[model samples]
Target: MSFKYRFAYYLVGFVLGSFFVAAVLTGKDTRCNYFPNARVLNDLRNKPFEYSKEASTVLAENWIDTTDIKNTLTYGDVDFDKSNIKFENGKIYIVEGKTVKNQAIELKVINYTSKAVLKEIKKK
Candidate 1:
């Protein structure tokens, strides 16, 4: 085939292939979390989340509700340096994120799991 014809054919095929891939993956839960922090946070979010009395009390005192904590976990930055895994109770992670209102906050989530708890969230 002529060069012009070949280029046109290649361009059309490329566009069609791109469209097919997008269409097939539309609305699918496709995510690529390559960073260590992102992978950790994503894994945590996928698991069940729970809270403790002390965590609730601290959250309430700091004007942070359950919803805020959920938002933070869903869209937060995990500070590995601030996380203390050698706690007597459970492993703790310091998660930082902004609220829906754009207010910045820090959270200390204790991963003390039982038959009921997955993660305990508190204000950092």
Candidate 2:
């Protein structure tokens, strides 16, 4: 009933509640992608990716295989400044990401109602 006992009880309860919440959500797909790069990567990973004609051509020109392209898409960075504004022309998002063996690459992803298209690949 004393001040010290009340404080102790509150601290214990808070710690236990936090642990319970963490445990309950341990199996959930909870990701904290707050930065622009992380957010773009998350968007790409969560949605289905389609390649545009131009982008495909670029890939072929560079002899970049599908697996390498996939790796780039999966682990690319977003040059937010270089990227176009999203939804400016119907969900057009230009995300810049680097590949394992390459640098200064970008993907112009046009997100449609049901899918996202990699419209262009550029070497910057």
Q: Which prediction has the highest TM-score against the true structure?
A: 1
Angstrom error at residue 22, model 1? 1.6
Please state every model's RMSD to the true fold in angstroms: 3.6, 3.6
Steric clash pairs (candidate 2): 77-97
Cα lDDT tens digits for candidate 1, 5-94: 999999999999999999989969999999977876776677677666767566666466667767877778989998857565567778
The candidate scoring highest on lDDT is 2
lDDT of 1 at 75: 79
Model 2 stretches with alpha carbons more than 4 Å out: 1-19, 82-89
Tens-digit lDDT string for candidate 2 (1-124):
9999999999999999999999989979888888877776677767887887887788787545666667766776666665656664446666665665666676777766567788887777
After superposition, candidate 1 runs with Cα above 4 Å error: 59-62, 84-90, 98-104, 112-124
Error of 2 at 39 (Å): 2.2
Error of 1 at 28 (Å): 2.9
